[model samples]
Target: MRADRLVSLVLLLRRRGRLSATTLARELEVSTRTVLRDIEALSAAGVPVYAERGRHGGFELLPGFRTELTGLNHDEALALLVAGSRRGAQVFGLGSALASAMLKVVDALPESYRDTAAGAVERLLIDPETDLLSRRLDAEDLPDTIVGEVRRAVFAGHKLRIHYEAVGQAPKWRTVDPIGLVTVREQGYLLAARSGADRTYRLSRILAAEELAEPAQRPDRVDLGRAWQERSVQFRTGGDPVTVVVRVNPNRREELVGTAVALLAEEADADGWLRLTVTFQDSRHAEWALWQLSTNAEALSPQGLRAGLRDRATAIASRYATP
Candidate 1:
C-alpha cells in the first residue's frame, strides 16, 4: 500500500511539476509525515525528487525525468479523459477518486500524446446541466455517508440494515443482503435479497443505511448484468399496468412502442398509420406519453383515456381562445 502511495505521489508531482508536502498529504489522503517519509524513500531509491525551502516552495522532480508509463495510445488517452469529464461517478460518491485516477492516467501517457488528447477532450462537452431545450440534467442527491455504507456492504459481502422510503409508503427499516449497486439514468439502486427474495431499493430513497456484522447470504460470484436484467423484467411486468390501443403515424410507431412497457399487437392502417396495442405502467403514464405527440397519436380504445385527452385539449383551447 505504501508503494502504491509512493507511485501516486510521484505521478502527482510529475503532472503538477511542483506541490507542497501539505498538498501531497491532502491529495494522498495521508499525513504530511507520511508524505515526507515517501519522499525520502523515493530519493534513496535514486528517483530525481528534490525539496525546496520557504513559502511557495515544496518538492519538485528534476527536469526531464519521466516514468515508464507510456502505454496509452492517442485514442485510449482521449477515451479516458472524456469519460473523466462526465459527472456520472458523482452519484456513486466516487467523483473525487475518478478525478485523481484520471490525473494519473493522463500523466502516464507519453508526452507526445498528452497535450493532443487533453486538447481534444476540451472541445467536447458532456452531460451539461442545461440542454438546447432549456431542460436541465441535475445529479441525484445521495448522501455520501449512505452511499459509502451501502457500497461497503455490497463489496464486503455483508448484510445491511437500511431505512427505505418507497413511493406512497411509509419509511421502514429492512435488513437485506446486497447483491450490487446500479446507476441508471442518473438514479442509483441497490439490488438485494430479503429473506432470499430479490428486491431493489433506490439509493436516493435510502434514508439511512447500516452495515451489519453478519456475512451476507449471497452467491460467491454474481453476474451483475444478468441480475439487473432479470430484476428489470420482473419489475416491469409485476406492476399494475394499464393497457392502451392506439393508432399512431408509422413514423411515430417506435416512439409509441418505446414509451410502452410492451407492444401486444400491431396492425398497419390504410392511411399509413399504425394500430398498436400497448401496455403502460398506468393510465396517467399512458395519457402523459401520448399527449406529447399532440394529434399525431390517437387513443382508439379506453374511452376514458380519450376523454381525458379531450378535456385537456379543451382546456388548452379555451385558454388560447380567451386571448
Candidate 2:
C-alpha cells in the first residue's frame, strides 16, 4: 500500500538522514520516481522532510520530528520475516542486512505475533541446495566483494565498469548502465544497457566490478519482469536455432526436454518409446543432447546428425575392439 510505503520512506529518512531517491527506492523495492513522489506526498502531509540540492543532495527530515507509526501489520511483518531468513536473494549480496532487518522486525512485533511468526518461518524451506534425487543443484560461487559493488551500482542508478569474461573470450573491460539484476536456478545475471543496447551479463563471469559516480542512462521507472521477458524472447529467437526430431525412452523424456530451448511436439510410439521434436540453440547443442542419451535415443531425421553420431560410435567401437 502507498500509505505503508510512505511511512517507510519517512522512517528511512529519519534513520538514515539525507538519502537519495535512488537509495530509498532500493531499500523500499520501488522505482526512484515512486520514491520521489513519496517524498512529495510526505512534504504535502506537513512532514518536516526537506530536499537539499547539489551533487550530494538528498531528502532529509527536520531534526526532532518523530512518528509512532508502525508501517507494517501482522501479515506484512510475517512476509518480510519469511523472506529475510531465505537464501534466494542472498546471491544479490544482502544477506547480513536482511538478517539484521529481520531481527529488528521480530523485536518490534507484538508479543503475541512474534512467536507465531517465528514458528511459521521455521516450517517453510526455500532454495534448498539438494533436490529429491539427492542431486545437488548448480549454484554459481559468486564473490561477495564483486557482487556487493555491482549491487550498489544497480541500486544507486550509476554507470558500472566491469571486467567481464564472456564464454570463449578473454577478459575485457565494459561500462554499462545497469537496469536490474536477476537470479535464476541459483545463477545470477545483470540486465544492463551498453551504448543504449540491452545487454545481459552473468555475475559469475564478472572478473571485477567498479561502481561509477556518473548517473546511469535509464528510464526512471522500470519493470524488470517485462524487460527480462523481452530479452529472453530475443535470445531464444536470435540464436542459431536448430530443430531436431528424436526417439527416446519414455522414462528419459524429461532429460531431453530440460536441455532444449523448446519442445515442438511429442507422441508415443508403438514400441513404447517417445518421439519428440525439440529445438536447441544450435547443431552442437542438439548433437550434445542426443549423445547424452546414449543408446536410449536416436535421431529420426537430419541425416547429418545421424551420420555424425554413427561416426562417433564407430570410432568408440573401434577403440574398444581387440584393443
Candidate 3:
C-alpha cells in the first residue's frame, strides 16, 4: 500500500511541479508528516527531489528529470482527458482516481497538445444536474462508506448485507449476491441476486452495506450489459399498465408521448391532430398526463379515464365558476 502511495506521490510531483507538502497531503489523503517522509524516501532513492525553504517554496524535481514511459498520442490523450472530466467517475466514487489518471493523461500528451487538450475539457459540460426546465435530474447522493462496501462486495464475489429502503416500503436488511454495479443516466444500481432471483437495487437507497466473507453464489464470468438489458426489459413489461387512446394537438404530441410507458399506435386526424393509443403505468398516471396538457390533449378511450377527467374538471370548474 505504501508502495502504491509512493508511486502516486511521485506521479503527482512529476505532473504538478512545486507542490507544497500541505497540498500533497490533501491530494494524497494523508498527512503532511507522511508527505515529508515520502519525500525523504524519494530523495534517498536518488530521485533528485528537493525542498525549498520559503513561503512560495515547495518540493519540486530537479531540472531534466523525466520518465520516458508515456505513450499516449494527441487524440488519444484528449479523449481520455475529456472522459475523465465526466460525472460517471465521480458518481461511482472514483473522483480522486480519475483526477490522478487525467493528470497522467495530460502529462503524457506531447507538449504541443497538452495545454490544448486540457483547455478543450473546459469547454465541455457533461451530465448537468438540472434540465432546461430547471427540474433536478436524478443525481442521488451515495455515501462513500456504503458505496465502498458495495463495490468491495461486487469485486470480491462476496455476499452483501444491505439496509435498503425501497420506494413506498419500509427499510429492510437484505442479503444478496452481488452480480455487478450499473450506472444509467447518472443513477447507480447494484445488480444482484436475492434468493436466487434477479434483483436490482438503487445504490442511493442502500443505507448501509456489509460484505460477508462467504463467497457469493454467482458465476465467475458475468455479462453486465446483457444482464442490465434483460432486467430493463422485464421492468418495462411487468407493470400493470393502463392503455388509453388520446387525440392531441400536433404541436403538443411529443409532450403527451413523453409520459406514456409505451406507444401502441398513432395516426393523423382529419382535423390535423394526432390520434394515438398509448399505455401508462396506471389510470392515475394516464389521468394526470392528459390533465397537465389541458385542452391540447384529450383522452378518447377507456371510459373510466374520461369519467375521472370529467369529474376532476367539473370540480375545478365549480371552484372557479363565475359567482
Candidate 4:
C-alpha cells in the first residue's frame, strides 16, 4: 500500500506540476508525516523533489527538471502528438499544455523526419460520432493499476488474487494464474487460468487485485492471443439469435439496415417498401432497431416478439396522444 501511494504521488506530481505535502497526503489518504517521509524517500532516489516553505509556496521540482523520451521514430512521434491532442481536448486544463509539449517534440525532430510526422498526423483521425469517454464498469476506475499488475504477473509467471464482479452476478474473490491481458473495444480484459480452467475477466470489473507469492507454471503451448479470440467468438455466439422481419419504407430502408446489429437480407416490394429479415442476439437489439426505424419499420416475426413490440409502440404512442 505504501509503495502504491508513493507511485501515485510521483505520477500526480508529474501530471499536476507540484503540490504541497498536505495536498499530497489528502490525495493519497495518508498522514502529512507519511507524505514528508515519502518526499524524503523520493529525493533520496534522485527524483530532485523539494519542499518550499512560505504562505504562497508548497512543493516544486528543482529548476531544470524535465521528463525525457527516447527511441521514437517519425511516425511514432506524430502518433504521440495526435493522441496527446485528443486527450488534451477531453481533459480540462490539459489540452494547451499537451499541445505545447507535442509542439516542442515535433519541432525538435530533424527535417528528414518532419514530413513523415506531418503525413502521419494528417492520417490519424478519430470519429467524432463515437463516444470517446465510456462509463466505468467497475466501482473504481483504476485501469492503469490493474494493467500494470497483469503485465508484471504475466512476465513473472505468477498467480493473482482478484476481487471481481461478473455481469449479473455478485462480487466475489477469485484466484487466477495470470496468462495475458487483452484489449477489446477500448476495455482491458484478463485471460487467466482459474481452477485449471481458462477464463476472461474484464479488467474494469476487477474490484481489487494483488499478486501472489508463488508463481504458477504456465502451459507449454498456451496461446494467449488465440484464447482471447476464441473467448470473443464464444461471447458473441452465446446470445440467443432471434429472427425478425421488418417492412420499412423505401426511403428509410438504408437507415434500417445500417444499424450495428447484423442484418441478414432485404428485398424491396413493388409498392416502394423493403422487407428485411434480420437476426439479432436478443430482444434488446430488436427494440433498438425498432426505435431507430421509428414508424417506418414494422416487426413481423414470432408472435411473442411482435406482440411485445406492438405493446411498447402502443404505450409510446399513447403518451403523445391528445388528452
The residue pairs found clashing in candidate 2 are none
Ranking by TM-score: 1, 2, 3, 4
Mind giving the per-residue lDDT tens digits that candidate 4 earns over 213-261? 7976568557767787787666644577777888888888767666525
- Could you estimate the TM-score for every candidate? 0.73, 0.71, 0.71, 0.55
Best by lDDT: 1
Off by over 4 Å in 3: 1-69, 311-323
Compared with the true structure, what per-residue lDDT tens digits does model 3 show for residues 168-196?
Answer: 99999999999998888889999999999
Best by TM-score: 1
What's every prediction's RMSD, in angstroms?
Answer: 13.8, 8.0, 14.8, 18.2
Which is the winner by TM-score between candidate 1 and candidate 2? 1
- lDDT, residue 32, model 4: 91
lDDT of 3 at 121: 76
Summarize candidate 2's per-residue lDDT along 87-126 as a digit string, tens digits: 6567787778888888899999888888888888888787
* Each model's lDDT: 0.90, 0.89, 0.88, 0.72
* Better by TM-score, candidate 4 or 3: 3
Clashes of each: 0, 0, 0, 0
* Candidate 4 ranges beyond 4 A from true positions: 1-73, 83-108, 111-140, 184-186, 196-198, 214-229, 249-265
In TM-score terms, candidate 4 sits at: 0.55
Model 4 gets an lDDT of 0.72
Question: Any runs in candidate 2 off by more than 4 Å, and if so which?
Answer: 1-68, 71-74, 249-258, 265-268, 272-274, 292-296, 311-323
